[model samples]
Target: MSGAVMDEIVMDGLRIDGCTVAFGGLRAIDNVTLDIPGGTITALIGPNGSGKSTFVNMVSGQIPPVAGRVVLKGQPITGLRPDRIVHRGLARTYQVPKVPKELTIQEVISVPLLYARSDRPLPSGVRSAADLAHYCGLRPAVTTRCGQLSVSDLRRLEIARALACRPEVLLLDESMAGLSLEDTDQVIGLVREIHVLGVTVVVIEHVMRIIARLCQHAIVLNQGRLLAEGAPQRVLTDPDVREAYLGKGFTL
Candidate 1:
């Protein structure tokens, strides 16, 4: 990363300071700290069991940190409830979307808006639940039940619902996992569209190509601590990052 770009990313956005999470006796996240620039796409990557999901969980308030703090847009948000965090302009999707199977797409999208306590209005061009669905590329009948949707469509619905919260930051936890190349490309396009709408996006993905294409900045974690962070092309090439996450001799 250029020093100029690094300076930009270090500006106020999302800040994690010495954050840690533990389950039983094992530390899932071990004093990791980093910054996610506002209005930019970032990739969080690591090998399995390297605290990637656990880091997102802590940021989105699904799991409380045992130490340190999380701040978004300069507001401290450590240990808040998930809904409370959403109300504070941060929302996230899961690796496996977990919507009520029986709920119609329209109904599912409406849930967040109904409970939205954030002062921030919905992003421009999205005025209704249907509009949100369309923005997310869900062109099926608004009445379609989530249960009947394809895996890709389900992922779209999950993102649309998160958008309903009018978040300033949206964390996508492997939104492209298990998708075909075409489906992954569609998601990559969707993420670009979302970024165009001015929301900061943090993507957790194992697909290095997607990360290379989608993120300007990449943060790598290994064994629950930050291993490397910088421009994607540069960070992915670091020997330590390669051996720890991408494996030796891997080429991006």
Candidate 2:
């Protein structure tokens, strides 16, 4: 399926071409580059203010890059509007699920489906979103208001909503934060299921266990620069990663 090309959508694997983003006087993403292979999960991790979220935002079009570009399927998409990027088959989820407090889980997911279709009635995919919510262990909370939902359910809802967009590539920004051990495991499984459905994922997380379990390839960033890239275990164990995490006390 990776070899099959989808019409009008560039599926040539997601690539970042020397991207950089700065705020005020500080560089948030410093000439960083990476690739998220089609049908694979890539994890990016870094300490606080290390540029993980900044880079993801730049690629997802929430923030414009100061230099370089974000490419999908071999086409340049950097600095495009968020809606335009969504039409390009890319969707992003935030650490906190941006649910409307007035809406039920069903309504929250349904609204996006309505907007995606515009003049037409809601599509059959609305039911698909429900099923995805169920599979993600959110069925019991289906009618609950977004304000009443727990952190895990909120994360599930966000993932379901992103799935409703029918994206080829999904950017998950710290989706596992503020969850219990059991809830985290459930989310990790749900992510695996999503990948099985052919959506390539780029996950930016600080939780090491989630990254190790789900990411086939890992990118380690420190102070807004690439520190290491390789298999999960190796990248996590790299000297620079240890130093970044533990400062001078980190030792081999």
Candidate 3:
């Protein structure tokens, strides 16, 4: 990447500072801090229960942090509702992309367009449902019910819906889980296109290959704490990360 691109990413971002979340006696996230630069794709990787999803949750406001704050573009957005956060230029997708089973692919994608803040309109501008379907590679299934589409298509549809919000920051949590390699690659390609369009995305994924291909920065969490942060190659290679996630006997 050029220095300009590097600077563009480094200079602006979402900041998760000293954020913690607990469920009864169990601390799901413990004082984790991470910086997701603007105009860059970041991977949040760790073993199950490492608090990756919890961190994304705190940022997206599905759940509030027990302590600490989440900042975007230097403004605190810690405890805002999901819709409020979406309007503030951040949106997210779940591991299992949830579309209303009753809605068509077009209706699913257009829902966010109606509620999302108008300050950041979609690049294509609001248009026919077909336009959104074509943009999201769901043209073939435009009229299809959300329940009828395949899993891969659902994931793509989720991205399209998220983009309909015109977010400056997008958090993707395990969208590739359970997907075939080809399907994972398909979503990865779509995400890359979104990133190229200037959306900073933070993806929580277990597949290292996907991380390597899509993320410029990687943050590793283990047992509710940050274990490593940096380029994917370096962070994934850290001795502690290897032990906690890749297993001691594994090598990349």
Candidate 4:
């Protein structure tokens, strides 16, 4: 899909309104509300316990929100099954890439491609499992078993699987966690490519440099609540956001 076509297709991407998730009396996400505009890259950043992963989980249907609505393209999808959510044009990857160690990379990517059904067609250039694998930079290792791949390759495979779902919105949870600088750059480039295909991307990352380089907008959460949001450079320099990460007297 061309960027211009994607822009015309996606208007209101995803919205979270008064969403809350609690675990045994403790709220991981507390009535937080946010909007992720379609066809744009947005960063979801925060301190360790700021509920970044929890928020993604809630939106992707891994966990049900105790109180709130998750709307995608004007339809409510708060408590749907994960697969249902995927079919609804939303998909996500995990902080840890979980795959069957015995499965080849192609096999893993094929699972979603074979089953995913969406109103929108698969992005241009991604028609088969091999094409998806190549798009994710895992073509050289296409036949390799998941357990035999490096961390970077595993991450790429996870992303390929998500792309197979043909999601209008893709949430990447800490996809670059343990990669080397060079590997990180490659993954960043891959993300940019995905965005160009017209997927609205929500990335959860701690690396400020990556967020600044890749995202047009940034949202910060502190203790399960929104602390700051705006352009990357401005949000990173917000007083509250700085304090949330580096105590009360430091700036990033």
Please provide, for model 4 over 1-252, each residue's C-alpha lDDT reduced to its tens digit, 9 standing for 90 to 100. Answer: 798765444346888899999999889999998878887899999999999999999999999999999989878999999999999999999888879999998899888887878767666867788888887888566788898988888889889999988898999999999999998999999999889988899999999999999999899998899888879999988887888899996655
Cα lDDT computed for each candidate against the true fold: 0.90, 0.79, 0.84, 0.89
TM-score of 3: 0.91
Please tell me which model should have the higher lDDT, number 2 or number 4: 4
Candidate 4 lDDT score at position 233: 93
- Tell me the lDDT of model 2 at 132: 57
lDDT of 4: 0.89
Which stretches of model 4 miss by more than 4 angstroms? 1-11
- Is candidate 1 or 4 superior in lDDT? 1
Model 2 worst lDDT window (10 residues): 117-126
Give candidate 3 misplaced runs (Cα > 4 Å).
Answer: 1-11, 249-252
lDDT order of candidates, best first? 1, 4, 3, 2
Considering summed lDDT, which 10 consecutive residues are worst modelled in model 1?
Answer: 4-13
For each predicted model, how many residue pairs clash, with residues at least 3 apart or on different chains?
0, 1, 0, 0
User: Model 2, range 109-183, lDDT digits (tens) per residue?
Assistant: 776665553332222344555665676679566777888887788888888787777677888988889889988
Tell me how candidate 3 scores on lDDT: 0.84
Give the per-residue lDDT digits (tens) of candidate 1, residues 1-252: 899776665554799999999998899999988998888899999999999999989999999899999988778999899899999999999888888988999999999989977777776777999999998889799999998999999999999999899988999999999989988998899899888878899999998889999998899999899999989999888899889965778765
Best by TM-score: 4
Q: Per TM-score, what order, best first?
A: 4, 1, 3, 2
Q: lDDT for model 1, on a 0 to 1 scale?
A: 0.90
